[model samples]
Target: MAGRIVVGVDGSEPSLKALTWAAGQAALTGDALQTVIGWEYPASWAALMPGVPPEFDPERLAKQILDEAIDQALTPAQAAAVTRTVVGGNAPQALLDAAEGATLLVVGDRGRSGFTAAVLGSVSLHVTQHAPCPVVVVRGRTGA
Candidate 1:
């Protein structure tokens, strides 16, 4: 059986960079590349929207973000080979849950600034500390 590499994508610049890195790693190692994305209602969802909009769909948006990230980061063949996973809830938990039995987990730094920029972003920090498998935090400037 082939190993699996799980990567979190949130459609951010850093996430796109992470997706590219994960795809390249998967290509080199022949691991199954799975891109995971998550979405949740904001804490003030009810306050923001008294009634749900007919066209509002967080799950569908998550899937589109995942797909766009893949398209932005990978070649057609690479994108085709990717497994897109959309989950409900936050990114860190989604990544950890998807990483079960994975050979590796990868994430972006979330492109923080100042003192925070020198350190891992909250999601990256959480996953690095708690991932079920070896985690690789892709670090670099965004849009570079």
Candidate 2:
């Protein structure tokens, strides 16, 4: 069994599927599962409206989104074996950072993309190319 299995979640259907797959793998291998949600504040807005009040704490928002996504993705029984992490950055970099020393890093085939034809988004491709450990891109029924 591996020591740890890490999965990236972004509250998308494919990401949820990836989380589910990672959870099953963790249970099968009796390894700890780390579910990570990566988020970055929009730089363009901050730059455009420098004087506007900050609407939210980026770290807190990240955690809240991650927690909600995890709750929605995992059942109570399956959630017990999982640990949650919220990172401040884009998906690929955050996943790579969290994958250090991890046995495996799991991610969705695609995420929050409006482009219908874009199968695997840039983040997944980047992570697959650069993650330190083996990376698994979970493809759902959409075949992305």
Candidate 3:
């Protein structure tokens, strides 16, 4: 690989799969792997709802999620991969922004829900359409 391999993670099973695939690709290509988690806080009004804490920080949550995902996705040998968390208006925008100079951008087919078929998630579809670099949508190893 000529540059870093960027992978988008969202704390979902499919995203974890993407992370794993990216890590392997990076190792094989002798390129750095970057795991990016994107998050956006709910509006102030939404946070003001009953029982919702006002001090919640979306960026912090994103970082925490990314760290956890990285821990789960990488093996001990792949621990040297670089990881990053991005706070953006949306996942697609953050991923696209990170893909600017990347050798390849990896993402999951479906995340959290809507995995009844092989369809890509909205963010992944958007990234595939607009990413500056090549995009890879990783599904399960068994092709489920």
By lDDT, the best candidate is 1
lDDT measured at residue 121 in model 3 versus the true structure, 0 to 100? 71
lDDT of 1 by residue, 1-144 (tens): 679999989887778888889898998999999999988898999898897887899999889888888998999999999999999998889999999999999998873222443567888988999988999988757442
* Worst-scoring 10-residue span by lDDT in model 3: 110-119
lDDT for residue 51 in candidate 2, whole number 0-100: 81
Scored by CA lDDT, what does every candidate get? 0.87, 0.83, 0.81
Best by TM-score: 1
Model 3 Cα lDDT, one tens digit per residue, 15-134: 999998998898788878887777765577565666667687777877888888888888866855476756666788988888889999999987665456646778888899999999
Q: Predicted candidate 1: what Cα RMSD to the true structure?
A: 2.8
By TM-score, how accurate is candidate 1? Answer: 0.89
> How would the candidate models be sorted by lDDT, starting from the highest?
1, 2, 3
